[model samples]
Target chain A: MQQEQSIAFKTGMLSICLFILLGLLYLPPESVAQQESSVPPGTAIPDSIQLKPPIHIEVKDTPDDAGGSVTIRWEEQPVLENAVIQKYRILRASVENSVPGEFIFVGEATNRATVFSDGSTDDDSTYVYKVEAVYELKVDDTTVVTTTVQSSVSDEVSSSAQWFNFQRINVFVGVVLLSFFILYYIYQAQSGKKLFIRKIAGLEAVDEAVGRATEMGKKIFYIPGTQDMDNVQTIAGVTILGRVAEIAAQYDTWLEVPVSRSLVLVTAKEIVKEAYSKVGRPDAFREDQVHYLTDDQFGYAAGIDGMVVRERPATIFYMGAFYAESLILAETGNSIGAIQISGTAMPSQLPFFVAACDYTLIGEELFAASAYLSREPKLLGSLKGQDVGKALILISLLVGTILETFHIWQFSSLFKVIGE
Target chain B: MRREIPLLITAITGIVFVLQYFIPHAPFNKMNTWFSDWFSIVGAFAIWLGALNLLKISFQKIMDKKSDWFFALVIIISFFVITIIGFAEGQGFREPGTTFSWLYDYVYSPLSATMFAILAFFVASASYRAFRARNFEATLLLLSAFFVMLGRVPVGDIITGFLPQQYQLSQVASWIMTFPQTAGQRAIMIGIALGLVSTSLRIILGIERSHLGGGD
Candidate 1:
């Protein structure tokens, strides 16, 4: 009887121990949280207790600039009131051939920050980005627990250098249309089609001015402006110089060209030499005639003024781009009783030239000088093409105005030079 | 060969530059920057060439004892002195404490400013000559100038104070600028643009070769 009683006691104890183990295994999650709270507050929380990952992460390439940047944006997922986010950690991975490589820690932003620009990317590369929300819990200002939850990786984005910008497509189209018209007219001109160009008083006076200078036995002064050869105005002035030089060579009149830029001086020397050669008076061509003055705007003006006062040329040509010194030069020329012909594309300086000079080639008339003087078929054709372009622009403006007046705005937007 | 080579180079470069405006690709952009750098280098060389030419001309004039040779001598001396100082001191020549800087600040700046200041007097003279109502166009220009000048000053407002706000001189001036002046300016600009396009096309196609000394 004693042996049987002992066996029963051992069995009962074993069963009780099994019941306790089973109870602990199936304990409610609230009791587990309570048990955890009963411990020291500084204890580390398990991974399951971490904050949720941020939601709706977006990655896109930056636009309208040299390609090298990607923008990453995200918002935090919903969390309990007590959840404290410390910061967000950003990671970047290079994507190659639709496969993502290992991610490297790129940068970090504060907890409240939701945007980051990854500017360290190479041009024409693909990339993926990941954002991690870092949460931190502090106990008694001494111990702290930190955890991180990573957002879903953004879709692959390939950054590429655009070969053509569609935003400026309107400008491109305009250029193409104008070029087509110019080329078509050029072909027609090459086939010996006659075209008419209006008379430019400033250009027509070229012969008169050279003739007067020859008759008066006084030199002719030509100032090809203050800008360098890169300027279109200077190029136009040089073209005019060729014709004037030819006239001077034919008339045996001394022609002086005082230039502000060295390149212009060289170019003027070449043009005059060629002109004299063409006129069979190369012996009259003087290298010293076309000289370089100071590149300073006012210095050139002062030099020209001195020349006007002392040498007292019979005629002066102020052509190409001018700034504040336009009136200064033109007035000084006027004061010397010299007939002045001026041309420039600069609108502000045009009035000054017009006010002081005998004849002023206003705006496009300056560009038209070569075509008018040379009367080359190709040049004449280009001039006619320019008229066509002007007519087109005027028509478009009228149509656009009428359409906009009727509240039909979409038609005008087609001509917008910028935006998507 | 000379003409052909130059024309070919010009055509290629012109087309490339036009394409560069539209292209944002790597090779084209790189080429554009390379060309720009080359242009800057060429510009520096051109400056040197200009300085050398000036020195040669001035020296010749001094030797020949030409008219105003003394001024040429002064220019040469000034040029050499500034160049030497700039070279010796590097960028310090532009600093305030340097002799070069002092010359530029006190001498050059004042001389340039004086020349610029003389423009005011010249403007008055030119305006007097231009506003002489010798013709109908001159009379119209004079009237426009008068209205613009009057409207720019505060006295114009006081003179037109009795008139309606829109009829005031300032308002009238604004209307003239906003409509007539703007219209004229736009017409000029459009014409200039068309001219530029045509001229550029002629140049690229080698039709306008006067700039290269003669026509093709």
Candidate 2:
């Protein structure tokens, strides 16, 4: 009876396995038939059904926030071309880096033909790109598709440079005024000119925040944003870190900097070391205090959020190029009841910082904050120069607006001349 | 001497660059393009400086063996690996079956999308916390934000009862964006522009050397 039962069970399991195998085999044939009926790759179409090549393949010029991507654009062929053209296949070949004539297919578009972009190429790379028009063909029993590849590649393009557009007429006026002020200030500095800038309420609060942290024996948290050292805001943030470190050193308080960017970590370390040296507390400046987190945006945020919660700091300073993480960090700091002062030039993230933090630096104020904290003549002169430039712009806008309002067409030309 | 040389270069290049914009002749335009190209070359060099700085810190962390040093090691390893796979091999993962290309398209793209998706949850939370009717201004903001958000989604038209042909929700949203959002954004933008102009002037004139550090 046991042997009979085992035989029956074995037979049932074998049938079940066979059914699944047959089902898998049956499913692929339907998909294969469907694929076979559709147009296949490299199938040549009739010459009568020709499609126009891509038009005006223009590469975009923009700032490279992250060093890897470049955007390429092209105008769509006419609607007639679109009907015949099944899809647009963008083929990219590296002219400089790869073996002489190797081309790679980076992107494709079946529906949207007008614009296709390729980030497959690196910024450091010089690439030659050619787009082709793929045409669909209906044969007796099968369909064929063909691509009329462009004869020559598009002009070699490179990433845009880091040069600021300093050539605007408004900026010209600004430069002149700023130059005058800078020269005057240099003379003033030589002649012992007394330069006075009002004390920043935020900076003034720094000492108290440090003292409170020292009293409670809690750490002071400093985040120098996620941006690398190239960004000016990060530099400004690190400068403020120097000041905060000095106070921490003097008060015998622990100051910790968790930087998102690796370069920022190095710079913040040096700045902290210098501050500790100046305060004669070099021994207290631990290399471990300033450390690097991951370069990944959210990964760094998660690390910082963990640190903020686990080690509840008395004061939290967020300054630099922050994005979505600003709110995450700021809200977490607020919940901890830590005094949070945040500053960033990123316009989109500014509102979050303002809503969540005790004090927020709006655009230029973040730049000026470093100068205000440092009180050096050179830095102060720059702040004054910035003001003069603002004055020039204000005057230009006022004059331009009034002229355009009064329908003085000839004066408009003068304004345009100045504008250029 | 230190001050004079920088000042002279700043004034000459600054004035010429600005003046060239007004004069649109071949020579001036070419000069502008040339200036931009030179700037790119310098920018490329700056990338090396940044990358070096990045490696220095991460390597130091690995050597020190601090807590969470594994993250630092991962960063350094990934950095060099990607750089090699991308530039050295030149068959970036998008190039068919290369390891780097596969990692980039499947791993990097999805990871990027995931990071961006975090904004949805954050927006929901932030809106919930901030969109309260505490005051008149807050109420107005809440109403506009609600309308904008609602109109963007498919359910917006459903809620508004088959939105009339003339008073389309999309048009209203566009109008709100154009008039109020544009006006406010432009005003902030103008201030930012002026700020940038001033900052550049300061940099060129050597007034804003804080970016370089406080001293000569």
Candidate 3:
């Protein structure tokens, strides 16, 4: 059975129509005559033929790319007097044996967008694209009118890899400049030049913390973070672990490292074993010392929390990337009254480490820890080189901000690396 | 020979990758993909090293009756249970209705979420300790924390609704975050980037060997 339209809704709609007609009566005689000839409500008023179909469709291979992309552009057609354009849908198909039915929806754009990029196309394969304008002319809340007009299909174009990404020239220059400075400094250091590095409180306390743990006869917990070996922070953490393992070996303090990633486990195990061997205490290094926890973040945190509670390590070192679990691990170590030293380049997690740990290595300090502990001249040279690089960046940022504020220049783009 | 082999591999691959960033042509692009593929292959196999080690320790603890032997037993049991079901069920184990996925959803997921939830209490406790005013910097931190905390909740609007827009606590909090906090974060990020560059160069040149567990 068909549902009947409500009498109240019909009456309300009629009253609205009567109100509009009454308003039209106050208009000038010429405008009133025009209004009388208007189409009835909820009727399809065909748009004028003057609204041109989209034309001048063009497709070009995306520049500065290793193939597999095409950028499409076309002239967007104007809308009729009352017709609204919702969007432009892009369609693509193989140039050979291509039919209108074979075209696939490659992407969509806003009504105002004049271009679309399709990156899914294969290299060396010719393809064609068509742009369709989708517009909606709604007569009322209960009725909507939609229409589509397709542009002519674009000519077949093929994508090929470029030899060099010219857009990334800025990145190339920056890398070369930094490498020059580092290499020059390294050469200088090889000639017996001493490099000065500022003291880091966290690094300086390594010896004291290890001694305390040794004297207390309790183990030290070394968490190289919950991240895999691919992270640069984990690499930094593992290097520091090398230094710490040596200290623990020399002091004869038992060390335990719980890891989440299997690769980190293998890497950390090898580093600790080598550190123990270097200190002539290879017998003291146990294979079980560097244990593997589940790769699940919270599961790893739970394992550490339970171990920290039960065994109650004398000292804990969190020296890598951490996320939401940073505070949980730190606070638990705090509750056990263990001296905690934490370090991470994660700006968000730095505050939690600073709040809960006895000493915190913020940002670059974690990367500098191994060099600081080792005190090798060549390594110290790189620190000096890094300082110089930082000085240059600081100058750039200061000048860029002031110039941008006063509109004296748009200088920041000099440091921007496109296609990076 | 052992150290030299690793160092040689590191240097050759690192330089190639640095070049790959600027060169989009063949060979370099192909090498980058090849390198990443090799990394994935090695990573897949590296899991066995960790799993075997984990089992060795767990078994040792249980057989020798060391401390926390029950936990070791639990780890062993859970590991085999998951591994066997995963191997047996293959792709079907990932189905929502299957036993493996059901165990993951019911047992593992809830336990993980609970552990994450515990972080909320830990954060409160940490903030409490951090807020104690012992010095000038500490006092400043405490004051900032007070405004930031108050501005985050509905009561802040109720308390400061009478004030002008600029002087309101919420405005102050937003200003602090947009300017000072953002500035500090950026500075750290810049420093980290420079440090990473320096470290990467050191590694590629074999000047930093502590990662090999020794200071050259």
For this target, which candidate reaches the highest lDDT against the unseen true structure?
3
Q: Clashes in each model (backbone N, CA, C under 3 Å)? A: 0, 3, 0
Model 2, C-alpha of B5: deviation from truth (Å): 12
Give the C-alpha lDDT of model 3: 0.86
The regions of model 2 sitting more than 4 angstroms off are A1-170, A181-204, A260-266, A331-337, A376-378, A406-420, B1-94, B102-112, B133-137, B151-172, B200-216
Q: Looking at model 3 chain B, which ten-residue stretch has the lowest summed lDDT?
A: B207-216
Sorting all predicted structures by DockQ, with the top scorer first, yields: 1, 3, 2
For model 1, residues A157-260, the per-residue Cα lDDT tens digits are: 75556678777788899999999988898889989988777788888889999899999999999999999887889999999999999999999999999899
Q: Candidate 2 chain A: worst 10 consecutive residues by lDDT? A: A61-70
Error of 1 at A207 (Å): 0.7
**For model 2, which pairs clash?**
A161-B40, B93-B101, B94-B101
Query: DockQ scores for all the models shown?
Result: 0.58, 0.09, 0.57
Q: Pick the candidate with the highest DockQ.
A: 1
Looking at model 2, give its docking quality level. incorrect
Decreasing lDDT order of the candidates: 3, 1, 2
Q: List model 3 lDDT by residue over A62-138, tens digit each.
A: 88888888999998676566567788888888876555446778899998999898989888678988887776655
Error of 1 at A348 (Å): 1.4
Which residue window of length 10 is worst by lDDT in model 2 chain B?
Answer: B207-216
**Candidate 1 share of real interface contacts:** 0.67
